[model samples]
Target chain A: MKLLRNLFVIIFLFAVFVPFGNAEEKRVRWKLAMTWGPTLHPFVDTVENMADMVETMSGGNFVIRIDASNIHKSPFGVFDMVKLGQYEMGHTASYYWKGKDMSFLPLTTMPFGMTTPEQYAWFYYGGGMELMQKAYEKNGMLSFPGGNTGNQMGGWFRKEINSLDDLKGLKMRIPGFAGQVLAKLGVTVTNIPPGELYTSLERGTIDALEWVGPGMDINMGFHKIAPYYYTGWHEPATELQFLVNKKAYDKLPEKYKEILKVAMKTAAYDMYIQNYHMSANAWSTMKEKYPNIKVKTFPDEVLNAMKTSYNELLSKYKKENALFKEIMESKEAYLKKARDWTYISDYLYLKSMSDTE
Target chain B: MKLLRNLFVIIFLFAVFVPFGNAEEKRVRWKLAMTWGPTLHPFVDTVENMADMVETMSGGNFVIRIDASNIHKSPFGVFDMVKLGQYEMGHTASYYWKGKDMSFLPLTTMPFGMTTPEQYAWFYYGGGMELMQKAYEKNGMLSFPGGNTGNQMGGWFRKEINSLDDLKGLKMRIPGFAGQVLAKLGVTVTNIPPGELYTSLERGTIDALEWVGPGMDINMGFHKIAPYYYTGWHEPATELQFLVNKKAYDKLPEKYKEILKVAMKTAAYDMYIQNYHMSANAWSTMKEKYPNIKVKTFPDEVLNAMKTSYNELLSKYKKENALFKEIMESKEAYLKKARDWTYISDYLYLKSMSDTE
Candidate 1:
C-alpha cells in the first residue's frame, strides 16, 4: 500500500508541475478584430500572416483567431471594442477614429507628407512611435503600424483637371481631411458608400473619386468608367494600425510577447511589399486593356490652392488639440531632414534614370 | 513483485516519451558566419536581430551563435564555409562570388536596377526568389535577402564630372561590375582595402570612390575631402544575402523552419529602415558641419556613355552564361511594368513636391 501511494504521488507531480515548468506548454488563445471585410486582400492577408507566425513560433501554444468586419459586424467600432477589451486587438486605420480624437488623424498619413520608406523610418527610429503611444495610453490601448498602402493615387477623374477653375464646384467622393481641404477649394465634396462609388462615377453622379492605389482600385472597375487617373498628393503613406488592449498585452508571457511583436512587425512590412507587387501587376493589366486611360497630375494652380487649404485646416487642428500639434511638429521636423536624404538618394536616382530614358 | 515491475515500466515510458512528444523540447544549435566585422552597423545589427528573434521565439530552445569576419578571419570565404557545412549559415552578399559564377552578380544589385522596394517586390513576388534558389542549388545552399543598403551614392569625387572627358582615365576605387563598366569608359579603376581608402582618397591616390550611402560613408571621412557627391547610378538597391546550408535547414523541425524564415525576413526589412534613418541623421549632421559639400549628378553626356558601356558588359556576360541571360530577362520584364508604377507613384510625387519647392 505504501509503494502504491508513492507511485501515485510521483505520477501526479509529473502530470501537473512538469508541463507547468515548460513555458511552451502554456497555452494562450487570443482574438483579433479587423475593420476590413473577409475578401480584402493584403489587409486580411496581413492579419492572417501575423496570426500564423505567432502560432507557429509558439509551437501551437499561442493562437490568434481573426474576425473580419462581416463577422464582427462593427467595422468602425473596432477602436471601442479593442478599448473595452471585447477583443484582444483590432486592425484598422487610425484616421477612422478622428471624430473621437483629433490626434488620431495624422497618425495614418498626411497630404504631402513622408513617403513609404520615409514614414517607416520616422515610425521606427524617429520620435513617431513614442508620440503614437502617448496618444493611445489614455485609452488603455497600445497602437502599432499595421500595414502601409505605399503612395495612393489621387483619384480617377471623368474630366482632366486643368487649373483651379477645374476643381471649383466639382462633385467628388473624397473623404476625411482631404474632403475638407477640397471643400475649401470650392469643390463639392461628398461622402458615398464604397458600393455606390462605382455606379456614381459611371452615371456622372460624382465627377471623380479617390480610392486606394491601383491594387485596390482595379477591382472597383473605376478605370473603365473614368479615363483620367491623377497622380497622388494626399495620403502619401497611408499606414493602417493595430490596436492592442493594454491589459491583455500585459498578461502575455515574456516570450509570447516578443513572439507577438515580431509577428506583427514582420506582417506589417510584408503587406507593404505585397501591395507594391499587386499594384504593379494590376496597373500593367489595366494599361494593356485600357490603352486610352490617361494618367494626369493636377495642374500647379490647383495643387497650390489645395496645399494652402490643407495648411489652413492643419492650423485649425493645431489650435484645437495640443497633442495634434506636438505630433505634426515632430513629423514636420523629421520630414525636413529625411526628405533631404530622399532627394539625394532615391529621388535623384529616379530622376537620373528618367533623364537617360 | 508484479505490481512493482509494472510501475517501473510505466515510469520509464513516461519519462522518455513525454519529452519526445513535445516539439519544444527538441534543441537546435546553429553557427552563422558573417562577412562583415563585428563593429559594422546595420549589417551586424541585422544578423544579431535575426538570431535574437529566433532564440526568443523558440523559448531559448533554438540558438544561433554568430562569428564576424574578425573572429572567422575570412570575410570573402563565408560562401565556401557555409556551402561546405563548416558553418550552418553565413551573412554575405551574393555578388562576392561573381568570380566563380556570373549569375551571382545580378543577385546583389545591377548598375541601373530597381530601387529597394522594387527589388524587394521582385524578390518576394516577381520570381526573383525562384531564380536565386536556382542559382544556389548547385552550391548546396539557399539564399535569402539579408538586408538592403537602399540607394548607394555614385561616388565622392574630387572634381565634378561635367562630360565624358571628365571620366577618361580618372583613377577611382570602384569595384565589381561597375568597375568593369567604368574601365570600358577609359576610367582607371583600382581596388583599395577599406582601411586605406580614406588616406588614399585624401592623398589623391584615388580621385574618387564609392563606399555606400552617407550612413556608412560619413564615418570614412570621404565627404571632408571630396566636395562632389554624385547621386547613385550603380547599385540602386544593394541587397545583402543570408546563405544557409541545405542539409542543416532541412534538419530543422517544421515549426522551427518557419520561425527562422520569419526572423530573417523581419530583420532584413528592419535593417533597410534603420539604414534610412541613420543616413538621414548622418547626412543632416554632415551637411551642417560641412556646408561646402556639393551634391551633383553626372552630365548627360557622361551618363549616356556609362549606360552604353554597362549594356555592352551585360551583353558580354549574357552570351557567356545562360543563367545570367535568363535572370536579366526576367528582371527587365518586371522592371518595365514596375518602373512605370514607380514613375507615376513615388517618382512623380517627389518631382511635384520639388517643383513646388
Candidate 2:
C-alpha cells in the first residue's frame, strides 16, 4: 500500500505539470507571417497584444511566436500563408483584398458608408459579420476588425482645392471609391505607399496625399511639405481588418477563440482612441512645428461632386457586388434607424442649442 | 584559487540555465489608480498593453502595479486622491473634476468643441496641452486625453423633443456645460452618478437620460425601457481626459512620463474605435434583438434651440469662468481652422457627392 501511494503521487504531479497538461497547453509558440511592419502602429500594437493575451490566458498552454525579425515582403502573400497554415494567423484590411472580391470593399470603406461607430454596428449586428465570414469562406479565413482610424484626414495637398478645377491635372494620392470620383473630376490620382509620400511630395512628384490621420501623419510630418491640408470627401471612415485563416480559427479551442475576439475588439477600439487623442494634440503641434502648413478644405463644388460620386459608387457596387448589395441592404435599414434617432435627438438638440444663442 | 574557480563555475551554470544574466536587472515598482474596475475592458486592455510596452522599453526595470481592484469608486474621488498623493498615478476625466474649477471643463469638453480627432490634434499640437496643464496646476495634477468616445449618441428620451417648449420641465441627466444649457431651455435638469442612472430611470426619477451614444446606451439596455432613442445635440463632441498627479508625474523619470503619454494616446485612440466598433454591432443587435425599440431624431426646431443654448452656454462660460476664457481664446483659433475646413471640406464634399451623377 505504501509503494502504491508513492507511485500515485508521482503520476499526479506529472499529469498536472508536465507537457502542459495536454496537447493544448504546449503551444507557447507563435509563428506569425506579416504583410506589414512594426511602424504600422495599430496593427503592430494589436498583434503584439494578442500574443501576450493568448499566452497569459492559456497559462503557457499556447504562445504566439511572432516572426518580427524578418517580417514578410508585403501583406499580399499573408493570406496564402495563413490559408496554407504556415502561420496560425495573419493581419490586414478586408479592402486590401478587393481583387479577391469587391464585396470586401463594402465591408471596409466607401465614399461615406459609415463612421467608426456605425460601421461597427452594421458589421457586428447588422449581419455584416456573417457576410464578411461568407466572403472569406473562399479564402479559408474568418476575419475580425483589427484596427480603425476612426474618421480619416481627407488628404494633404500642395495647392488649395478651392474648386473642382483644382483637381484637374494635379497629381494626388488617393484610393478606393474616392479615387473613382476624383477621376471623374479630372484629377490625376495615384496610389502609393504612405512611407513613400514624403519624398514624392518633397520632390514635387505628387501634389497631395492622405494617410491615417494625425497619430501617424504627425509622426512623418506630412504637413511640412503639404501646406494645404484639406478635409471632406476622400475617405471618411477607414476600418482595418485582421484576417485569420478559417482553418486555423476553426482549430482554436472555443476559449482561445473568445480571447481572440475580445483581444481584437479591445485592440480595435483602443487604436481609434489613441489616434483621436493624438490627432487633437498633433494638430496644434503641426502648426507650431510647421508654421508654413495651411489646413485647407476641399471646395464646395468638389464636395458636391464627391458626394454624387459616392452614391454612384454605392449603386455600382450594389449592382455588381453581391456582398455590397447585402451589406447596403442591411446598412440602409440600420442607417434609417440611426438617422431617425438622430433627427430628433442630436439634430433637434443641436439646432435648439444653436438657436438659443 | 581552486575554491573560487568552483564557485564561478556554479554561478555560470545558474546564469546559463535561468535567464539569470550576470548583469543584475534593477526594477522600480509603482502603484496606479484608475476610476474603473479591472474588468472595465478598455482600461484593462490599456493597463495590460501599457504594462507590456513600458516593461519592454525599460528593459523590465520599471513596473506598474495596478491598484484598480480597490481604487475604483465615484470617479469624483480619483483626482483628489492623485492630488493628495493617496496614489502614485490615476486615470480619470477632466470634467469629473469640474468642482476643482469650471475652466477645467474646457480641457475636457466645450459647447460644440472639436471632434475626437480634431480635439486630439489641438491638445497635442495646438498649444492646448500647455494651457490644459496650466489649468491643472492648482489641482496638483496634469491632464491629457486618456480616452474619447468620439461624437456621442445624443441621448435617450421618454418623450419626444420636437420643439423648444418640449424640453421645458423635462428632467435630464447631464453634466458639465451641456447640462447648463439644458437648464436654459427651462428644463429642470439633474445630475447623478452614472452607476445610479438605471435606478433613477426605472423609478421614473428623471424624464430622460443622456449618457453616451447608441453604442454605450444600448449596452446599458436603455432602449429596452426607453423606446425612443433620440439623436444629436446633447453633447456633440464629448472627450475623456487623463489626470496625473502632479508630484507623482513630476517625480517619474522622463522615460516614464513618455510611456504614460504614449499609453494615454494609445488608450484615447482605442476608446474611439471601441465605441464605433462595438456600437456598430450593438446598434444592429438592439434593433434585431430588441425589435420593439424605436430610434428617432430630434426635430429641427429642437436642434436649433440646443445649438442656441450651446452658444449661449459658451458665452456664459466665457464670462463666468477664467478657465473658460483661456480655453475659448485658444479654441477660437482652433475652431476657426476647423470651421474653415468644414466649409470647404465636409460641406462641399457632401454637396459635390450629392450632385455627381
Residues B31-96, candidate 2: write the lDDT tens digits.
Answer: 667777776655456556655555554445567777674555545677777778777667666777
Residue-level error in angstroms, candidate 2, position B178: 6.6
Per-candidate RMSD vs. true structure? 1.6, 9.4
Give the docking tier of candidate 2. incorrect
Task: Please report the candidate that would top lDDT against the real structure.
Answer: 1
Best by DockQ: 1
Question: Over 4 Å off in model 1, which ranges?
Answer: A3-7, B8-17
Candidate 2 residue-wise lDDT at A87 = 75
Q: Rate the local accuracy (lDDT) of all candidates.
A: 0.93, 0.65
Candidate 1 on A75-182: residue-level lDDT in tens? 999999999999999999999999999999999999989999999999999989999999999999999999999999999999998988888889999999999999
DockQ, candidate no. 1: 0.69
Deviation from native of the Cα of residue B318 in model 2, angstroms: 15
Please give, for residues A251-293, the per-residue lDDT of candidate 2 as tens digits. Answer: 7665456445655665666565455555544665676778887
